[model samples]
Structure formats: structure tokens, C-alpha cells
Target: MTVTETTTAPAKIWDKAGGWQGVGTAVGILALTRVGQLLMIWWLGGATSEPRSVWDRLLVWDAGWFLRVAMDGYPHGYTYENGVLQGNELAFFPVYPMLIRFAAAIGFTPSTAAVLISWIASIGAAVALHLLGTSLYSKRAGWALVAICCSAPASVVLSMAYSESIFLALVAGMFVAAHRRAWWAAGLLGLLTALSRPTGAAAALGLGVAALIAVREIWKSENRIAWQPITAAAAALAGVPLYIGWVAWRVGDLDAWFKIQTAGWGTTFDYGSSTIKFLNTTLRTGDGWVSISIALMLLVALAAAGVALTQKPWLPLAVYGVVAMILVYGQAGFYHSKPRLLLPVLLTLLPAVVAASKARPRVAILSIVAWAAFGLWYGAYLVTVWPYTL
Candidate 1:
């Protein structure tokens, strides 16, 4: 049967045995990807340029700051003056750093804990992504989804000490659980997303919207939302207050979190016209394949989002993608980094995944393998070829 004729729920769930294979494949992918990333780091360490090398720069940039804060709890020290805000450390949000600090208290060093936690969360990310693909298309689609995500060059974030993997896992879980009508699970995950990343706003919004549509279907009425949807709405709302509260307590101001984002983090709105500006500059700036690839991918990702918006199962991904693009591209003074910023929203490409799954079984399997191989090599090459990033 063609994928469209089938409702996906039954045909998409793994045979009970496929679960084991999935886990094995996930482990293998994670190991090799992480090893490749680390090897690049080791290769860069001996270079005379030291931190100025591509590997050193990428490691030291935002990720390095996060690792430092994760290792040392923010003392809430230092005031902004003379670009000292850079050292004052007001640029980052508190959640992921808190996770690193808490994990370290139990036993793990900040860096070790960050990598370990991120690695584990990457698995969660893969599983949630699989379920999302299966929900929209088929079980075979889920396998393909997981394979691409696990190996995507951007998927390397899973091995890093960053919040993308953790946030994606939680955000993806929120949507997948909502699709299954698991109200409390969805609500809880939705709430956690709010706390995890600033982009949590987008995830929460997407989740609440998806849940409302779902609750309507479940109750066969539009007037009153079910408990799950209400819970999700509440969870999504909770982030604003939590953010405000933290800002108030730390900065002695109601809008400190967002204010710092604007004043300190360098994020601002360009309304996509600047996206054109960015595209032009990058193409003219003696750019290489990596820059061109990222610029093209960002545009393609936006188009795919239109396809995602039509279906309920994929709607959350669409909403998140649109919101993410605006937020990232709008504030993006640096156009070169869009790949890492937006790549975590892999579900935004669901239509493509679904279309690929429509192929005959042998072709589908081969397509998945090729995609994974590309991700592995491409991601490795990004770091290896440049050697000085951030």
C-alpha cells in the first residue's frame, strides 16, 4: 500500500523485535560520531595556532562558555561595562548550566557530566525522532529518521556539552507524546522544554497547539479543551513566569532575561530581509562549500516547513521550524552558523522523510544508509576541513 492510504499508527510502530535492533544501531552510531568529533579535537590540540585553529575556535566559542558556566555555577557576579559583560557571563541561559552543575555535584566532572548527559539525551532524541517519523509516515520511516538524525553532521551536537541534544529530545518527546494522547507525559515534557532552552518557547507553543488539535479530535468538540491540552497550555505558560522570576531575582528587573538576550547575547530581529542580506554577504565573502551548503539548507528547510504545516502530526514541527527560522535568522549577525542553530529541528524535514519512505523497500533501505553516511562524513569534514570554528 502507498504510504498515504495507510493511517501510519499500526504500520509505523516497530515490530517488538525491531526495538532491539534500533537500540543497537543507535549505540553504534553514537559511538562512531562521538569518536570522530573527539578525534578532530585531538588533532587540533597539537597545532601551533592552539585555540586559534578551527577545532579550538569551535570548541571555545559559545560551547566553551557554556562548559565554563556549567562547570562553575554562575556567581551572578560582574556588571556590564567596557565589554566586560563578555566576561560577566550574562549571555547564556541558566538551565543547561544548572544541569551540568547538579550532575557534577553527584559525581561527574562538569565536562564529563555534560558529555555523558548529552550522549544519553542524544539517544532520547533519536527515539523521539523515530516515533515522530513513524507517526507521520511508517515504521520504516522511523528507522530512516533515526538513522539520519543520529548521523547528521549537526547531530554531532549530541556528543557535545551543549543543550541542543537535550532540548531536542525533550521537545521531540513533547510532540510524540501529544500525538499518542498521553496528556500528562506530554504536559510534563512540554513544561521541561520551557525550562531547558530559550527556544523552549517555540516548542511549548508548538506542543500546546498540537495538543489542542488533538484534544478536539479526542472529544469531538471544539468548545472545551481536554485535561491534557489544558495541562500543556499551562506548562507552556509556566516558562514566562519562571523566566521572569529568574530575571527579577538575578538582575533586579522584570525583563532581565530577554533584555540580556538583546543587550548581551547579540540576538535581534531582522525580519528575514536581513536573511537576504546575510545570504548575499556569505556568498560574496570568499565562502567555501560549507558556507554554501548551510545557506542553501536554511532556505530549503523553510520551504519544507510549508509542507509540514498541512498535517496535524507534523504541525508542531512546522510551527517550531517557522519560529526557529525567524528567531535564528532574524537575530543572526553571523550567517555562517545557521546550520548548527537550525539543524536540531530535524523534524521540520518530515515531508522529505515521508516521501523517501514511499520508495520500494530496497531503495528505502539504501536511501537511509546513504543519508547516514553523508551526515557522518559531512559533519566530520566540516570540522576537519576548517579546523578553526566557533
Candidate 2:
């Protein structure tokens, strides 16, 4: 081979991997956001009467549930507390906890393993987000996407023993693979994404849309059908049902999973009635700043999703964003958790990232840093001072 070919081959591979510089920049931006947020958490924690260490704080709320799952495994039936059904480890997905269990088996404590897995997954998420953005837009947009997402409100979960980081990484990577028409990777990632969270159902549906689009284009142009996209879509679509079916079989009830969720967390699809009522009441008479802020954030997310539609993003992404928002808005659950749930709705952040990518470098950096300042602090405050489950 020629000397030019030898050098260019590695460059081509690196470019396909989002380029060394692009991925490095994205991870660097994520590191800064995480550090700033951790410091904020420490400061806020110190102000409390019973100060908790940052490490301890990261293992609070849902972290405990994940740890239980990692160490003890899921119960065979529903849990009851004081004769009332309660949410249990079954409500949590298995993949994150499974990884934690694996890590712990290698010698780390369960808590340490959980936190370590989440942090590692978050870094993977940064890389995936960068690749997705770079593929859809540009390197600047990729870096901006990583910066915006890692510092968004409730992004503290990325640093905690939570599954959001793993879910985000898989979902973002799945999207990137689908966009690039890598059927094998897309299918595997999609299946894994589905197993990570209930929201994976929406993600799988989005993958289906992408697959259909690819199939249609291929059929029109090549006069022959491509089976890979269809097969990938089928694999993706099966993930949610597969898990739900397992839960049902284990509990010997068809609706066991849904019942557990509803009983434990009051999580059920209410067709947005609960969301509407919450917003109406919060807007009219809610006195708490946190509640007010959450309500506002929900509204802003809806507006942003609408604006994103106007930008005509890739159809699959649009479908995922719309369905995911519907799921988030249409559910009856913890009111404060909406922002965290919305963090992976990359569509909502598209306009801002696109605009930032087009702006002067200094302007973009300043804008993102300003956003990170508030976003990171908001997340830290939620974990440190809000005194509730996120």
C-alpha cells in the first residue's frame, strides 16, 4: 500500500469514531461539568445540619434500591409494607444493577460498584452524544450536545448510582448506529437500551421508525428489499415486552410489573391529566420554589420540543422525542422527577446546540458555561438540599 493510504486509513477510522479531538473535547467538557456539580453538592451538603459526604450523597434515594438489586437480586413477588403494596427492586431495571453486581464481584463494595458503573457509563454517554451530534451536525454541535446534556438539571443522576447514565449511553449510541445504517450495532444497542428503562420502549419505537425509513429508501432506489433494518427493528421492539413478560412469569400475573409500578411509585399513564393538574395547581398556588421551578422546566421542555420539530431533525429522533415526551408528560409519578426524565430528550436541546455550533467560539463557550453554572447547581441542589427522591 502507498504511504498516503497507510496514514489516511487510520485517520478514516478515527473520523468514524468521531475523531480523537472531538471525543476528547466532549469528555473534557463532561469532566468540568461533573467537577463543578460535585463541588456544588459538597458546598450545599455542608450547609445542612446533618452534613453528608459527597460520596454518601451520591448513594441516596434510588441509589439504595439499585444497590439492593445489585446485591440481593429481585424478589419473586410484590413487596408489602404495612399491608400496602410497595415498590421494590423489581421496579428497577436489571442491566445497571447487573453491571454493578459484576463490578462488585470483582471486589468493590456494592455502593462503590454502582457509583463507579454510573460514572463510567456517563463518560460513555459523553462519547456517544458526541458521535451522534457529529454525525447529525458537526463537531462543534457534538461538543455542545455533550456539554448541555451533562450539566442539565437533574443530571446529578449521571454521577449517582442510577441507571440514567447507562440508558443514555445506550440510547445515544443506538441512535448513532441507526443513523449510520449499522444494523447489527443498532439492534444490539437498541435491545440493551430497552432493558435499561421503561423509556426504552419509546426508544425502540424510534428505532422502528428509522428502520422503516431506511427500508423505504432502499426499496425505492435498489428495487430490492433490505432485511437487516427490519430484523434490527424487530429485535429492538422485543426488548421491553421481553422484560415485562419475564416479570409476569415470575409473579404469575400478567400485569404484575405495571401493578408494582403503580402501587409503589404511583407511576401509570394518565394521559397527561396528572401533569396538567400539577401544572395548573403549581402555576396558580404552588409556593415552593422547587415546585415552581419544576413546573416551569416542564413547560420549557414542551416548548423546546415544539421548536425542535420546526428544525426538521432526522425522523427517528423526532419520533423518539415526541413519544418520550408523551410518556414523561402523560405519567402520574413524582412531580420533581420530570426534569431528570427529560434530560435524555436530545431533540429539545437541538436548536440550542445548532445555534451554539454556528456562533463564534468565544460566544458559544461563554453561553455553555453560563448554562452549566445554573444547570449544574440546580442538579446539585436537588440532590443536596431538595430533600426528596429525584
Candidate 1 yields a Cα-based lDDT of 0.65
- Model 2, 107-183: lDDT tens digits are 99898899999999999999999988887888888899999999998799999988999999999999877877778
lDDT of 1 by residue, 6-91 (tens): 22121222344324345555445556656755665455444534344433323434676677777765546345777555333445
TM-score of every candidate: 0.82, 0.95
lDDT of each: 0.65, 0.88
Runs with alpha carbons beyond 4 Å of true place in candidate 2: 1-20
- What TM-score, to 2 decimals, does candidate 2 have? 0.95
- Using lDDT as the measure, which candidate wins? 2
